[model samples]
Every structure is written in structure tokens, then in C-alpha cells.
Target chain A: MELLCLEMDTVIRARPDPNLLYDERVLQSLLTIEERFLPQCSYFKCVQKDIQPFMRRMVATWMLEVCEEQKCEEEVFPLAMNYLDRFLAVVPTRKCNLQLLGAVCMFLASKLKETRPLTAEKLCIYTDNSIKPQELLEWELVVLGKLKWNLAAVTPNDFIEHIMRKLPLPKEKLALIRKHVQTFIALCATDFNFAMYPPSMIATGSFGAAICGLQLDNGDQSLWGDNLTDLLAKITNTEVDCLKACQEQIERVLVSSLREGRRQQQQQQQEQAGPRSKALDELDQSSTPTDVRDIDL
Target chain B: MCRTMSINLSKRILTALSNGPTRRNLFGPVDREQLQLEYQDSLRKDLEDASRRWGFDFLTETPLEGGDFQWEGISGTKVPALYRSCMVGAVEVLRPRGASGLGSAAAQSGKENIPRTPNRDSLKPQSLEKTPEKTQSNNQSNKLKRKQTNITDFYQAKRRVVATPRKSGQ
Candidate 1:
């Protein structure tokens, strides 16, 4: 049996330029590569159109929930996004298992960004033990290798922070704006156009778009008058179609939450009445018979 | 001629890996030795570059029979044992300076200075300074004092730690 060990010297030579910035051309090439690789297999086809939209939203929501639950930093999200992008870019679709892909991305991101990382076993348990710990570990290495260990991608959060500094908003308002934009990021998976936008561009565009949506909804158009409008327009083209698509996705997620709340309420109401009605029905049926016979005897 | 031959060989290997169909067979036994040598050469170059960037010599020397020892590469100096001891002493003296800088900085700031104490009370709405004006002013003052104390304690502790060893020896 021939054993292969990577030469450490070659490994060092393979180390990517840490300061290499992702240009628009590089970004486009990555997106094109992903498109080519995805439809190559059955598994890739499974997440192609409508199914992909929901999966993307679910993965995004799960990432946020996991971050919040573990008290992990928000930096983990961008790292996760980068991992997801790179994995999708390189690993052909046929080999893709979205569940494993999501878990692996989260695992890699957590390791990169968290000061103290959650172990594979702990993450498995957190994901309801659906994915085995060993599988996650293996997939992490696979994802890392496919990415060529290049982890220097500009993320959406970087863009948002820059815009927030420039925006004349209080900390709380800035946070609110961030939240609104993040809600839109969940829809980024739906469009291949998202792959073309730099993370910073996406973030700035989404934020400015969300602010305008809120202003219009509140019937305060003047709130985002000339200067902010000109600035946002310059940062992002701010097309009506794109903005509406983002807003609709955000509304869909919010509406889904509202529906879930209503469903829970209805379930609770049914549960509360279920036993009482059963007892009442039993009482009505047995009211006049067996007890009287026993007493007479 | 040897250097040229090696460079040519490396280029051929790289091209084979990147574009040639013979990549799977490129790392055969014959090529393995060549690859190993090339790798070592690359590592030596990297280490030399790192040493220069860091402004330190990593090579150590040994005493020879005739009161002379050979030194490796640039910045060659003898007195190996003395150099090692001095480095250890320098690190020991520097550590307390770093700790005291952090400690005094925390103390000089009006905020509670207890390290690693997770203050749950601060999470309460009532304890938080909600007004932007007051919070900004408080943070500014704390930062100013913290900076002043950090510089002062760093030098003071460095002197103390270094002086203590000398005094004990005396």
C-alpha cells in the first residue's frame, strides 16, 4: 500500500496570499463555477428552484438561531456564509447534501470565529442529533479542502458596518436597520444574482432598501430625502424589482412567524378543551344507570 | 548548473501538477527524493525570511575543543548558555509588566476592576445608563484614565520584576 503524506513545504507554498482581495471577476467566476457544478448531480437538482428558496431561508434562520442560542458572535455568520459560498462553488451539486453542507459550514465558521468552539458532538446534539458527529467532522475536512483553505472573503457584515457608520442613526436605530437587512439576506439563496454582488454591496444595498421600505410603509417619505437617497442610490442601483423581491421575502418570513404563533395558539386552545369535553361526554352517557343499581343493591 | 537544473525540475513538477495528465503518477519513488529536497530548500528559505522579519537569530552554537565553535548562518554569536538565560530572564521580567498594565488600567477606569467577573446586574434595565450623553461621557473618562494607568504600570512592573532577581542574587 502506498501512503501519501502532503509535503509540509508544499503546504506552506500552497498557502494563499492572506491579503488577496476578491475582485468582481473572481466573484463572477466563482458563481459560474457553482452553477456548472450544481446541476451535475441528482442531489444538486433537489435544491434548484422552489425547494432551494425554502432551504436557503431555513438554513439562514437556523444559523441565526444557533448563534443566538450558543452565545456565539455574529462574526460566525459571515464566516458561515463564506464557507457556504465556497462549498457551493467547488463541490459539485451531485455530491451535495444540504443538511450536511449546512452543518459543516456552521462547524467550520464556528471554529474560525468563536473564541471557544462547540465540539462536533455538541453541535450534533444541538441539531437534534440528526447528523452524526463523525459525518460532520469528515464533511468539515472535505469543505475545508475544497475551499483550498482560502478564508478571506469580504462578508455582508463588513459592508453593513461601514454604512452604519455613515448613516445618521442612533445605535438602536442602526441595530434595527441591521435586523431588517439580515431578514432579507435569507432570500439571497433564491437568486443567482446574489452570488454576483459582493458581500459589502449586498449589505449596503439591503440596508438602504430596507430603510426606504420602512419609511414608505410609515408614510414618511421625507425621512429619507435627498442626501440619503443620493448616497444609497450611488451605493446600490436600488432597482424597484430587486428591492420588492427582498421586501417580499422579508414579509414572507415575518408572516410565517405570525402564522406559527397562531397555529400554536389554536393548538393550546384545543388541548385545553379536549379533556373537559371528553369528561363531559362520559358524564352524560353514564349519568342515570350503573351507580343507581349499585346503591339499590 | 545544479541550481539551474533544480529550478527546471521544480517548474516541470509544478506544470505537471497544474496542467499535465500525468499528475496521478508524478509523485513516484524517483520523483519523491527530488520533491523532498526541493521542499527542504523552500522551508530553509522561508525560515531565513521569517528570522529577518522578526529581527532575531534562531541558530545556537556549541563549544569546541580548541576554544572555538562554528556558528550557523548570519548574526553568529557565541555564549549560548548566557544568551538562553538572558532570554528567559527578559520574558519573566516582561510578563508582570503586561499583567500590571491590564490590572492598573482596569483599576484606573471607574468601572469595576474585578477580572473575569461576569456582571449579571449590568444586564438589568435599571442598572444600564440609557441616555446617550451620560454613557458617552462616562466611557470617555474611563478610557482616558485607563490609557494613563496602562503606560505607568507597565514600566513600573517591568522595573520591579527585573530589579527583584538582581536584588535576590546580591
Candidate 2:
């Protein structure tokens, strides 16, 4: 059935009207907007080839920070991403203000998923007051209309929770597993390629495969590899691509951060010496005012 | 022979009656007598079922007066009165099999048949009497007037709220 669906989708893509190309253009424009607005976080310099994984790491770190600060559920982040993806699917790029769009998506998802909802004003303030409260509210309506009032979204949290329920691991190992899964999520955001994959697949495949890979790398290859192979067979190509992109981005960001850390250290040392040396040179020049004093004598 | 033909014709008439009316007049007065009869019959069946399920005697006494109903403790505590009332109302509306059979017999003999024309007129609103042209113009005018008010209020409220904070802060 999945193969049939894929075949149908391919056929639909192959025979499309000129007007249908608008969706592709819109997708490209949105991607461009994301690239321009969010960019590769400072970690891009270290691991250039595997930037997506680093991006996911950044996102996971940010999500943890936000969730902890607001006392909101961690699930809200993935829910927000789901809304953003579905909204992007339908709403034409030209009709949206991307910044407002992003913020509104987050705001709506927070309201939908979180047990305790944040007020529109609070969310606006949280975004550094970049947008007015009224504007945020207005964007909320615009977003709802554009997405035709679709509020339900399956999130990475749901996928992770389901997978965890099925796994036969102890609580301590499960906790470690969850942490790795979240880390993979942060890495996912760095990769442009990951945007095309459905959010659930991205979450499940990355975490599931990462756990398997981690186990294998640590020399516990026998059991996990078989389990992972079965898991991978069930996953779609799109999901695998997304996982690969996320992994690549993560590796890239790690490498980039390492380089950035070194560069920062060098810059700090130079910065410390720069002012002192200038002051000493000035003192030397002043003490050499003896030539002028001798001439005066 | 003439008597036999009349009997055959009456038999055909009875068959037609058995089929009932295909289309009902909507605007006429509701058949209250029929409704009441249906409700009573349903109440009786429900009481019977309740008695049977509880291993109690349904026909023995006046059940409405609240004797020690046998099912009271067996069904995990006594049923709430409001829930009982709701269930009774639903059964009344639904008109179960035995209830419908008894009620229809009463309805066939009842004298009050609501006129079809009155029912039709009552079903449609008097506003629909307007000429199609006038109705279209009136709808368009109403829509335009409503649109103006909505847009004005929407913009004014938005501006007022947003402006107040910046003006005070500045």
C-alpha cells in the first residue's frame, strides 16, 4: 500500500499543470526564507559537510532551554514544527510574512499541545517583542484561515513515545535514549533536506537508527543491528533521506563548533594583548621626549 | 357477488392504508395524542425489561411507587434519577417496536387529522414570499452594510489596542 501510494505520488508529480508549479516555487521561496532568516547557527564553521545534524543539536538545545524556562511540555516544539510544515504545504509564500508566520505557528502549536497555554502577549514578548501582540493575534487568524483550521498534528513526541513503549529497555537506558533522540531532533533543523520529510518519520527514524548505530559503534552490534535492519526496512526512502540529512548536519555542526571554539580562543588572546601593547608603545614614545628636552636645554 | 366485490375493494383499501403516507405535511400541528400514546407504551416496555434483567416481578405491583427494586445493588449502585429521566425521554422519542404497534392502533382511531396545506405553509418562512429579484437585491444590500461595519470595527479595535501601549510608553 505504501509503495502504491509512492507510485501514485510520482505519477502525479510527473504529469502536472503549469499552475501546479507554484507549489514548488512556494516551497523554494520558503526554504530561501528559512535559510536567510535562521541560517546555520554558529556551529556551521566546524563540520561543514554534516551541518544538518549540528542544526538538529542546536534545535534540541533550544527546545530544552525553552521548555525548561516556560515550564511548557517538550512536545510543543515538534507540534509547532508539524504546524509549520503543514502550513507551508498549503499557504503560498507570497501571501505570508515568514517571521510572523513562524511565530504564529509556534504560538498556535503551544496553545494546542501545551497543558498550560501562554497568552499571545507573553509569546510576543518572548520573541523579544519583535512583533506586536495585536499583530500576533491577527497572524493567528491568517494562519488558521490559510491552513483551513487544521489543528491536529502528529508530532515527534508522539513517535518517540510510541517507540519507547515498544522498546524493552530499563528506565535509566530509556532516559539516555530519550536524550539522544532529542539531540538528533536538534541536528535535524540544520539540514535543508530534512524539511521535505514528514516530521514523524524524521523523529522516529533518526532516533531509532541513531540508537542502533550508537549501540553498534559501542561494540554491541549483534542484537541491535538485526533490530535496526528490520526497523529500516519498514521506513520509507523519504524518511531515510531525512535521517541521513539530520546525521550529516549534526556531524557538520559538531565539527564547526570545534573550529569556532579554537578561533574564539585565538581571537580572545589577540584581543587581550592588543590594547596593552598599544599602551606600552605609547609610554615608550612619551619617555623618549628626552630628545626634545635636550634641545630645549 | 356484488357484496364479495365490495369486500375485495375494502381489502385493497386496507392494504393501501398499511403502506402509510409516503410524504408527510410538515407545517401542521404535531400529533400530540399519538406522541403521548407512543411515550406510554415505551415506558411500559422499559419497565418490563428492567424487571426481567433484575429478576424482579414486573407485573406484580405498582413499580412507579419505588418498592425495593431488585436490581438496585446488582447494577453497581442505584441509577441516578436524571439519567433515568434522560433514558425515559430517549425511549419516548425512539418509539420502540411494541410501543409503535400499540400507538399506531390508537392513532388510526383518533379524530384529529392536521390539514396538509396549513402544514406546508407553516414549514416555509413568510420571508420566502418575496419576488426573486427583490430578494436578491435585499440580500446584496444587507451583505454590503454588514461588511462595512465588520471591517470598520475590526480595524478600529486593532489600531486602538496596538496604539495605546506605544503611545503610553513613548
Candidate 3:
């Protein structure tokens, strides 16, 4: 007799252990070490001469697109950005090598975070093969060496669950809250200004912005305005004044990125002569980032 | 099912990537020779820095003069069988590749054996930044297990490099 074999091949993710997410020590320890992992300096001023801030944004946007298209775990993009920031903090990389560095960062982060890590071949293809697989592998060691072999640096994403578990968010909107928080976090990663901020602050700021965007803070006084900032600051041990500034920065970034995304989308539509309907534009506005001209920060 | 979904996903990626703006190279053509030269220079500088900081020559697997670390090497026999990648006994060839397991980042690297040189690059990129005191006294056996070999050797170990208090992480 022949037997039919059957086993689902879905990615096996561990359930969030309460021991990790709920334990006070886990959260506190994360806050303590989060600063240690931030890039050592505002690299554009001192360490880098050939590369500009805009170049970093260009690579970051591409990296985010790759992560999104490949369905990489949420932490992978942020974690890779951490490595990129840290490496740039030290190494004066040439502009020509920046994309190679980005690919190497993604390659390392995927290996660290994914069940099936992305192959070097695949990453090269994503760069339109501007970089070879051999180059990616060779640079991986150089990047690793500069990182001091510390691949486990704490990222803002680490604080998400720790912060969320403490928030008074409605149970039904937990998933939506997480989605927005992650999007905000990714946006911050792409921006160079947030590069030097503590991961906990970014996580805290993203949480504040995310909560506001989804309007999940309705009917709760403790979750509104200054009160919400105080609550978030308390959770992450960030100063209230600083947390307010970071959240405002995040909001500004969201508006600008939304505009940038739309500008590109509109250009593409014009080239094809397929004018997008206003109804569709409004629908799109509800979802993507905007970098419009008139949004006041 | 996941495989089929990935196949569909990859197919979509292939078509979009042909002329997709997302797929273009950001920085024009790279000077491959200069990049390779820089890679070599950077690796040499890193090894020298490691040597000075640890007081051990990682390239030679030996101690250096006037270094922070006091280097001592026990014979392979002196080290426990568990720490050795291949035991001297019958288990040499048959050891499962996953023996190092996950989170053991690059543990057992041969990369540490590359020949070293004095620093060559005039552009000292990150020398200005201060390295904090190496506070964490990581266990000896733990350090030996997940060490890096050359880039070509292994991707076997998982979380080999834990985020310890050692800021510069050499």
C-alpha cells in the first residue's frame, strides 16, 4: 500500500513568550542597552565625505522595497538599518559602494532574522546585478568586522511588544496598532535624523504616532495629547519633552514620505497616460505616505 | 503551499524587475578594483586594531606585545571534546553540521587566521570614536565555539554573537 505524505510548509514562528514580552526585566534591559547600539555619530558631518544624506535615503527606500517585496519579517528591515547606521558611523564608504553595503546589510539581517535567509544571488538580482554575489559575501565580513562582530544589537522593533503590552489599546485594534507602529518605525529608519536617536525613543515615538494615525486613542484621556506622551515616556523611560519632539518628527516624516510616494506614483501614471481617478487617489491617500507641499508640521 | 506561493511571488518580481525603477542601481558603476583594495585595507586595519585591543594576534592565533588581553592557548587535547569542532575520536566526519546550532553566530570561523599587515590606509575613518572599556567578561569556552573563519567557510552557527556589553565587540 502506498501512503500519501502531507505536512504544511508554512514559516514556523514562535508564539510571543510571556516570559520575554511581559517580564519587567526583559523590557528594562532592552531600554538600558538600546543606546549602545545607536550609530556613534551623525556620520554625514564627520565620517562621510563622498556620500550625502539623500544617498542614504535612496538606499534605505530601496532596502525597504526589497524587504516588503520579499515578505521579510518586520524586524529585518529595521535590524538591517541598524547595521547600516552602525557601519556608516565608523566606515567612510564611497557613494558607489553604498548600494553594495545596503545589500550586504540586508543579507546579514535576513540571515539573523529569517527562517530561510535570502541568498546572495537573490540580493544581487534585486540590485539589477550591479553587485556580484562574490562582492556581497566579501563585504559581509568587512561590515561584520567594523560592527565588532556584534550582530545582536538591540533595535526599536524590540521595544514594540514591550511598549504595546503596557498600553491601554483596545483589544480589537491590536493588529492595526502593530501594523502602523511598524510602518512608522520603517519610515524613521529611512530618515537620517532618526539614525542617532535611541531605539527606545524611536519605538516610543512610533507608538505615539501610530496610535494617533489610527485614531485608537478616542475616549481615553490618559491616551491623549500630553498625557499620552507622559505615559509613553514612562514606559520607555524616555524624557517627556524628548518623546514629544520625536513623535512630532515622526508625524512630519509620515506626511513627507506620503507626498514623495504619491509624486512618484503620479509621474508613473502620467508616463502611461492612465490618469488615476480622484476617487482612487483618495483611496490611495488613506493608505500610503504623503510628502505634500502644504502640510504643516 | 508556501513553496508555490513563493514561486508566484518570484515570478511577479521577475516581471516587475525588468524595467522597474525599484530595480535600478542607485550609485553608478562601482570601481571593483578600488573596492577590493579597500576591503583588503579595511580587513588589515581591523585585525591590527583587534591585535592592539585584545593584545592577541587574531591572524596568528597568538598573543601580541603590549596588548590589553593576556593570551593563553591550551592544546587541542586540553580543550574539552564539546568545544572542538571535530573530536579526536570516532565522531570526526559524521558530526552533523548543525552541531553549533542557532544563535551561535559564525562560531568556529577560520577567518581569524588571515595574515596581518601594518595599517596602510591614510583615511582613518572611525579612529576618533572612543571604545568604552570592555566590561563583559564573556566565558572562554563560549568565545572559542562560535568564532569566525574566513568569509568563505561557514554560515552554520545561529546567534553566535550575543549583544554583550563589549561595545567595540572585538
The top-ranked prediction according to TM-score is 3
lDDT of 2 by residue, B1-93 (tens): 333432332232222222122122212232345434533554565567566555576577333444455333234124433344345554455
| Steric collisions counted per model | 0, 27, 27
The model with the greatest lDDT is: 3
Regions of model 1 farther than 4 Å from truth: A1-60, A89-97, A130-132, A170-172, A179-198, A209-222, A225-230, A236-249, A260-297, B1-170
Question: Chain A TM-score of model 3 versus the true structure?
Answer: 0.90
What is candidate 3's local distance difference test score?
A: 0.75
RMSD of 2: 36.2
By lDDT, rank the candidates, best first: 3, 1, 2
What value does DockQ give for candidate 1? 0.01
lDDT of 2 by residue, A1-297 (tens): 355522121111144344533344533333333322221223223334322333333333333334435655556665565555455454433211344445576678777765345556555554455456667676576566545576665444445554554445555466556655654553453344455555555565655544653453244442264454345424322344445555445444433433343345444555788865555545543543222112110
Q: Of models 1 and 2, which has the larger DockQ?
A: 1
What is the per-residue lDDT of model 1 for residues A143-174, given as tens digits with 9 covering 90 to 100? 66566566654556544544555556655455
Point out the higher-scoring one by TM-score: 2 or 3: 3
